[model samples]
Target: MPTLFSKYAYYFNQLCEFSPNRLQAQKAKNVAPVRYPTPVQKNMNLMVDFKVENKVIGYSLASKQHAHGNCLVHFQSTINRILKPDSFVVPRETVAISICNSFFTLGSSPTDFVKTKQGGKPLPEDSYFTYKMVTKHVMIVLYNSEGAEEQLAGFVYYPQLLTSRRVCPNIDETAMALARITYSSDNGPEMFARFCKKTQRDVIVKIMNGGMSATHMDYNYILLEQNYGSCSECNAFHQEKMKKEKKEKKKSITEKAASKSKSKSEAATATETANSTVTPPPKTAPPKAVDSDDEYDFGN
Candidate 1:
């Protein structure tokens, strides 16, 4: 039996040699779609995928080499590897949070996260993430809503035990709570909004009161919600929302200008008509002199 490392190495060999079928997505150019590996190949790669907030985050890789942690980082200095800075690259901090979110949510022992779970039918997860369970552990319970007749989806876990939930508790709570409310009909938007506000207030206050040396878990609005949304994609969502609002405001201003222009035109037209009606109109030019019959005709 190949060791995990050996198996990954084998998969990596395949990934390196793996060529995707070319697809002609656009015309007018000699271009084809890059073929992706079979599901089997992708799944095999996911064996080491990382998790965040019960979400799997796939890091765009420079190669098919199976790697985790710093080994898995996006760019390779030695390899002269590069990715578009704007590419969907996640920050290291965000990556860390994503893993924490998943580990704690499952209540899986940190040790399990660290070691591979053989014959374990792992839950369906994102393809981008892998988990490593450490031996030490601490459990923290965060609620979507607690002491409510219908408790919304919340999280419970220990950071020393799990990495995914450690970085961003608020974000995950907000997301899961909303999901439960939306799909399950167990909670509502209002419930979520309230929960978010209260929870944010609580967490923020705790952080503030704790002084500057607050625990990583105690502060960072972003870290708090990393599980809910901290990855680059989630941040994009936030940015897009702001852009939409700005567009709407600009549209409103344009509409107002158009409306004002129309009003001004109408008023000017009305004033012109009033002036013509009220004030004497300029006298029409005197009728052109009749060809002066009286003016001597030369041959008369």
Candidate 2:
């Protein structure tokens, strides 16, 4: 029989063997470390909150080239959200649903939370969230080729809010009041000013406007999502578009060649007609009469 320590060690090794993060970590060893410049805004020196749940998992830096690709707010959570390679294949939407079920709940299971929309106004069924909620909350966007809109990937929740709810009996009522106020208002600068300070407002605005301008910076990185390269619909559309473009190009070339050939035939015919119409100058009548005029041709 194996010792207790040995058994645990074996289990740990087995888990590491299937760990995606472990593989990434090994890859990182060979790659150079990337450093990001500290961002400063307004009176507040804005920095990524590395402390989550009061535990330091990893440093959160402002990197445009992180794994998630240009995430405005990246929290390096200790937990790995990726599924194991050997585990049964799971759809991304299914994974999103599982995360929702584990972390949040409504009065019931809220199993359809992944498919359901949360907002006051009517919207397309595929929309992930209300525009207002997105402006106010920290959220992640996930997408696949088939979905009409990007799906809700993940969300961060503050444990402090839960603690406050547990301690403060009237927290629900206060929350309801806030919710009513939020719903009544629009997602504008004024609304954001009420909830956030100047720096937060500016950062969120830039993010909502599709990332701040980093063009002036020399070493900025390009961000891309994991599934950015795996869009079947996009691939098919590109194929069809290319085929149409190629056919048009061939048709244009053939038309040009035919036009040139026709022009050459027309030019030959014109040259032949012009040559045939030309008549040599009538031969000059000899000046026989003039020669005799100088002599004794006083003519009778």
Candidate 3:
């Protein structure tokens, strides 16, 4: 019989094999209802809370850049929320979710965000955080060496992608970020599935209600949701709003231009009309001086 310690070690190894893998979650074969491809908002800061030793910390991550991303709130709060810094390492499940969320929310980029918006080169797998850009979206996921357990933590599905160089949850760091998703979660697979479903739905509804935009890569997204992706309308609301805003802006500009042109034309016409109506002063000869001198001579 294997000792509990050995059993845990084996479990940890298996769990690490699939921790928050985006590659498997977003396979091209699984597409869903997508009017267009979602835009990548890579390097955006995510909200995360963690339990270290016996203390808990929260932070607004700008990706795992860690250079200047640590939040005082996280450091202080985490110290209290998690085990104290002096305490030993905490369980992986306790750390993964919070850390993953923090990294995902960050939107920092090596270059200008413009390139990241178009799917830029990703960081290495060994990198603290990788920017996984696919379609028009970006997310981040991290790997942990210890403490992954199906009891409380979940397994991650990672896929080797061949098509686009980008995926979701920052899988492209190693090769391609296809889509990182949880394996078997403890709260019952169905429950976790439902949770994911709800999350996707909520995000889609949020986007749609907020008015998202359509993109050129819609068809591909629908293709992936079949196996790797979910067809949640995360940004639908935003899409509509964006399109509406764009149209309104264009309309407003056109109207303003028309008004300006009309005013300009009216002013020009007024100038021309004034010039045509006015007559130049008759060229009055310089006869006044001569007439004065003649009058004086007559008197003399």
Candidate 4:
């Protein structure tokens, strides 16, 4: 078996011989090195073991060799990899909490979170878990267990969490609690709202009112406003209600104006009718003839 160092040395020698500089020098000298059909003729089935501190951690198999100009390159695919001893593996709970914190700090959407879990892409440190938007206002996190099974890691009720700045505890119990609440219900936001109303109302109100560090609370509100117009479900609901009331109030104003105009029109019509029906005083000649007849009867 070739040692890892020996294999590396062989590849390095092959690369140097066919390097661009070497090719240029050969062309200048009018001397061409013998060309081979492929980069490496022998050791095509080469396997190199990766070791750390005398222990094999992983291995790579040379799949194929190709020629790039004058350089012979072997492409190797790593297999059965293991983390090095000094590698820092973040705990699943910590990853879940970091994701929740990112919502506040980065204003990252659920879609952004999901993109990080995509295969063949290098996942960012903050995006180890998968984000699933279970509802408009609710999201959940998932992680792969040791058995390679997807398991629920945590949940994020964005509206409440963003508004209250309350993150889930970095414990399995928190995930369990969230799972229990959301297991069978689709109305996640409403259910979460009810839960908060029953148990966390005071804490939420305190946070919202700057009972926490006022400066920190203000900063969060600024970010919330910039990212999502209204941070809380309560605020969104109130905004909708206000809009409805405004519409009703406007409709009432228009109706009152219409009624006033109609009343004015009817009053004008009545006035005109009274004036048209009025008759001039009875002719004066008739009154004069009655007076002369009455005077003659009195004299008699």
Best by TM-score: 3
List of clashing residue pairs for candidate 4: none
lDDT by residue for model 2 (133-182), tens: 12111112222223453333333222111112112112211222233223
Q: Which ranges of candidate 2 are over 4 A from the true structure?
A: 1-227, 287-300
lDDT to native, each model: 0.31, 0.28, 0.31, 0.32
Compose the digit string of candidate 1's lDDT tens values, residues 18-127: 21111111110222212221121222333334333333223222223332333223222211331234234443322122122222233232212221233675633422
Clashing pairs in 2: none
lDDT string for model 3 (1-300, tens) is 469787677556534543334333443223332322222222222214322221122222232332111222222333354334432322221212122221122222211011111146563443222123232222223322224321101111122112323233222221211232232222221111211332332111112222333211111122222232334442343345567879999999999999999999999999999999998888966755557676677655
Model 4, which residues run further than 4 Å from truth? Answer: 1-231, 286-300
Predicted candidate 4, C-alpha RMSD: 27.5
- Which 10-residue window of candidate 1 scores lowest in summed lDDT? 19-28
Misplaced by over 4 Å in model 3 are 1-231, 282-285, 288-300
Residue 175 of model 1 has an lDDT of 31
Worst 10 residues of 4 by lDDT: 70-79
